[model samples]
Target: MGLFITFEGPEGSGKSTQARLLYERLQRLGYPVILTREPGGTRIGELIRRILVDLRHTEMAPTTETLLFSAARAQLVSELVRPYLKTGGIVLCDRYADSTFAYQGYGLGRDLEELQSITTVATGGLMPDLTFYLDLDVEMGLQRKRSARDRLPEPASAAAAFTPHPEWNRLDARDLAYHQRVATGFAELMRRDPDRWRCFVANQPVDLLAEQIFTQVEPMLARIVRLENPR
Candidate 1:
């Protein structure tokens, strides 16, 4: 299997930016790579993303949100991620199952075990080879998101306009306590699987952070190449 790397973080933590930077760096280095985002990578996933993030969907329940996200994720993995990995091309995802664990399970107070079972079925047990968690203060992250929403025009949909950052969604409007729980949830997740996760303080300069990530990833890719093509 090829490399499967994922980016995870709280709102405004710059995960998407770092993921995009890594994707470009890998491409410039002549690696076969694809960068995709959660809830909206595939055609079907994009449709699901609309419902999950629409600012008007105020009545949507936590369970409903979980199911919608899982549906989109399942479509993405089946149609794009798994197939790409089978071909030995790197797949860089902006988020994955871990988001569900952090957002729905922890932020919204859903059952983690239940979310895990649902996620397994949704993803067919697929997991990332490495996950980058961009850490930032919960309030700072949320504030950044709010500022972006104030400044950036809202795209018609996730796949419509290629904005630098995503428009603020319904989840961005959640209470501070909920977001705090989500941050805590991410911490607990990293603690559970330290080897697979690389946590970075996200407030660093963008170029510096991207270099840090690429430094770690480049060595791993070298190791994989060596193992596959032993002398």
Candidate 2:
């Protein structure tokens, strides 16, 4: 069977960059690999991505936003992920269900059970074999991005007519209390899924962080090679 690895973190945690590095390393080692991301990775998913990420759609509801994310993920899995995994390709995903749980369930204050149910249905029981959770302070995470870029609607000007922000993005503009809740929620997630998910401090330099990740990944790679070369 193929390996499905996902990188998860708040915006600016460097998950995307690390995911690319891992993909490149695996490719150089002669492993067949597919690199993709959620809210995208398929034609239908790409269309949904625009709806989900556009800063102009500030009126989008929480439930509606969650459903759209689920929809895009369903299409991505059915159209691209499964096919590649069947051929023994290492699938490196930039964000997955964890983002929904952190951003929607915890950050947006949605029902956690409901979010999990919808995600399970969307993914068709497809879970990552391994996940790396890049941990960073919320302020640092935001600093890494310089500005809101992860599907957050731009904050309205003070003089404009009142408009409610979508729940997912509302978290982005929240006070320290809400962001603290998000951080706690992610820590709890890591605690609950320790076997499948590994939490790494993202405060280190990029090269050092990459080395730490490779230390974990190298063993898995060796095991895979052994399996393939079994006498």
Candidate 3:
């Protein structure tokens, strides 16, 4: 099987940046790799992402939010992720089913078992080969998000072609307590499957963090090569 790596963490944790860095690194090494993000990847998934993140959707129920995320994921896996993996290419995803568990199940107080059932159907039992959890203080992460939102250009500006500050969405409008639970949820997930997770302090310097992540990923790539060429 091809390498499937996921980045998970609280808001403003730099998961997306790290995923991109890793994707570039793999490409430089002549490995086939693709970088993608959750809630949006394929055409259908992008539509779902719009609904899921729109700030006006504050009234969206927990179950509805969960299902929407799952729907997007189902489309992403079938259309992109699964097929690419079949060709032995690496996939670097910003988030996956784990975000659903962390945000909906733990943060929103939804039933974990029900979420698990839904995720199983959405992903068709696909799981990440390695998951990097970029650990950060919840309050600090939220503050970073606020600062980022403030830096975005106005909608009418030429630089702002699409939505203005898309990352600052309805989920970011949630309370600090809810985000704290989500962080706790991530911790619980890592504890449950320690072998598949690599936790890192999100406050570290960017280059240092990227090097650390690359060091961990290099061994996994070697393992994949050995598996494909087992004499």
The collision pairs in model 2 are none
Error of 3 at 227 (Å): 16
Deviation (Å) of 171 in candidate 3: 0.6
Q: What's the TM-score of every candidate structure?
A: 0.91, 0.84, 0.93
Best by TM-score: 3
Native-to-model Cα distance after best TM-score fit, residue 182 in candidate 1, in Å: 0.2
TM-score of 1: 0.91
lDDT of 1 by residue, 156-191 (tens): 897654323355777887899999999999999999
Q: State model 2's lDDT.
A: 0.79
Candidate 3 per-residue lDDT, tens place, 142-167, comes to 89888887897557864444342465
lDDT of each: 0.88, 0.79, 0.89
Candidate 2 is scored at a TM of 0.84
The regions of model 3 sitting more than 4 angstroms off are 157-164, 223-231
Error of 3 at 187 (Å): 0.7
Q: Which regions in candidate 1 have their CA more than 4 angstroms from the true location? A: 153-165, 223-231
Candidate 2: regions farther than 4 A off? 147-178, 222-231
Model 2: per-residue lDDT, tens digit, 1-231?
778899988767888889989878777777777799977888899788767765557789999999999999999998889887887667899989888888788888999999889999999989998999899998888765655343565556853323432223333555656666777788888888899988899989888888888787777765343224322
